[model samples]
Target: MNKLLIALLVFLFFSCAKESDSVAKKRITDEVFVPTLKIDSTDLLGLPKDTGGIHKGYLLNETEAVYAHMIYTPGGYQESGEGYPLLIFLHGWGPRQLTNEIGTDLNVVKEHGPPALIEQKQWNPSFPFIVASPQLEGQYWASADVHSFIDYIIEKYNINTNRIYLTGLSLGGGGCWYYVGEKGEESHAAAIIPISARGEASIVSNLTNTPIWAFHGAKDQTVEPINNYGSVTMVNEINRNSPAVIAKVTVFDNAGHDAWTRTYGNQFGETGISYSPFNLNIYDWLLQYKKE
Candidate 1:
């Protein structure tokens, strides 16, 4: 063929190819085949909600008694297989909040804490947790009750030896730290979250690698933030040399002493500093730690 004809033929072929590419791009712009990978619900690593079914119990001794409200796995307490984490919850001063007298009834504790989250607020935990909230017989937590309850539940449930978590509010917040103080490394709890509570910084020195996230309200008068949140700062100071024992405090400006109402994991909302109208999910943060 002539050179001019050959050149014309080549140009036509190139034009056709470009046109074809343009058409394909247009098709994709209109509707491309986007692929999605489906995940199985069972394969998902998560926890189920308690569905507001709280069982009541009493840890009693001759001179001591502790009322408890518990929520187990969705499969129930006995049905939960292996590797379930236990969430030990200590409710804030409930005698005055729940009832006037200690002998009144256990119904008061249910109005707040994990019991209130699941039953009243309809809060759902996004992790498979066997949560137990102890209603203090007095104004504060009794180390004896915490120690006994830990033993009791360990014996009763198929608990994850490493993933135990401790959390509480107000008086209960201090109690959580108090338990950590008593057990320290021996507690075997993976992480600790205290809302509106505190303990001596000297005692927290023992938590060399235990993770702590404390929350407090600036406006709280019931239990000042400095007490509990200050305790967290003290932990940070004490364990500054240890990478594993860093403590974080999320302080709110307008919130009151009821910081737990805002800062709990996977309840009321999906965790966060838990401002009045918002929730910053911290459940994942709590789940990040495991016993070494």
Candidate 2:
């Protein structure tokens, strides 16, 4: 009788532990959303279909769902032998409904960054990376959400793990800063380009090893140019070196909060310097770094 009782107690304990673990796993899997591997027209109305262009689809988990996000793949992505780099582009704040409600129009995402260029039929087909732009569901872009989506993208596509990049404008720019600052060395972005938003300078130490090229308008009152200037300056101060000082900020002296237009459009005005120190565009600058 004593032996039987002891055996029963052990069995119950083990069963409870197993059950707890199962519940925990299910909870985790359900909470975080993951995009479907097969991109489709589920929420793509005003957006272009995935005919070797921007593809729209839903990011869903077991429990919750958000509206469709846009992703752009290179022309020969399916046939490429080598893994292509991945660029995760985050957009700034849009219409109030875009974040507060479900089924918001997907076209708002293309208002800035690479997605806009794609919609305009101006994105170079030879561009060498896979781009994913996830819309903000709430007021801000959370780092955890960005991390999870990145994990999904890395797994879902033929991504070069060493060459992942991140960029954003306005509110999205702030998200970029928050993501890299919060994740530190684990952020996994080879480089980040933040435009028109000043992020927290308190997180400067976190950016020591990360290459950054921040842009802001000098005369802007919306988000002062000092925000980005101060952050980048602190980074350079923390890790002072010549060519080694990879973190830099470019303030458009005559421009306003809309510095992203020229930057993303790769259109530097007459005073805009586009060569020598760092040539071409932000895209080329991003491709210059790869994690060791």
Candidate 3:
């Protein structure tokens, strides 16, 4: 009788766990998402099987022919064949405009942000998202160009459209602001993390519906802290009427321009300095919202 009772408990435990997982998945499926960008299938490359690990490639652009990119797929990606969330990282000015040679310039991209973590093998292999870091040829990344690249990549992979996230540092952070402002109601990203950059106050209305979590350095002389604070404040003021989305900002008192390192490295969460009440890392914070 004891053996039969133990067997029944084990069955019930597994059944409850499976049901919880199914309900979580159903929540994601029930969320509605209308893709903002028109997927451009032209010049799409024949991608290799996603057996996992980082793959280097270049964007097929006529005007900007030398745009290089790196993609990292977590381990066991091919086994599930499920649509995975996508994280697109835009690098700042230092890594851009390198020669089109994939062998040399491509390595510059992996020196920072998510790519750096993956290259050093510090990133968790079980992390579920596919990270795409794109290098720019110009000083500033245009929203239109970024959107075109997004269209190109979606056609090239099995991305969960509703869970697409955008993140960047410095100029790339400014690029994130530009993207949402220019796209306005048509932005495709579900959330954006802009570090050490300023957003335009005039575009606060455009960001009312978008989820924003900006970061800045208190001593940042390059880009003043007010830029990030001002924009977030504007958005929150307007949200007082509807309060659907709450914009957040984390200012590192001792830090300067290089705020992206700690953020992308999850040091904030590890050191218990995260602005989030739950001490969630940026990845966890980003995953919480998905066009719902």
For all candidates in order, the CA lDDT equals 0.62, 0.68, 0.71
Task: Give a tens-digit lDDT track for model 2, residues 1-292.
Answer: 9999999999999999999999999865643433122222222222222345545644433223332467777654563346677888888877223442334555677777788887787665224568888777778888888888888777777777887899998888888888988898789888888877766656667777778888776677777765444433443553563333467776666778787888888775432242112224677667667766
| Model 2 global lDDT (CA atoms, 0 to 1) | 0.68
From the highest lDDT down, the ranking of the candidates is 3, 2, 1
Model 1 error, position 145 (Å) = 2.9
Best by TM-score: 3
Q: What digit string (tens of lDDT, one per residue) describes model 3 on residues 32-134?
A: 2221333222211222333447555664352243346888776555533456678889888888855877767778888888899888877752236788888
TM-score for all models, in order of appearance: 0.68, 0.71, 0.73
Q: lDDT (0-100) at residue 206 of candidate 2?
A: 76
Winner of 1 and 2 under lDDT: 2
Candidate 3 C-alpha RMSD relative to the actual structure: 12.1
TM-score ranking of the models: 3, 2, 1
Task: Report model 2's TM-score to 2 decimal places.
Answer: 0.71
The C-alpha stretches of model 1 lying farther than 4 A from their native spots are: 1-73, 76-80, 96-104, 227-232, 239-243, 265-280
Identify the runs in model 2 with alpha carbons over 4 angstroms from their true place: 1-54, 59-68, 95-103, 227-245, 270-279
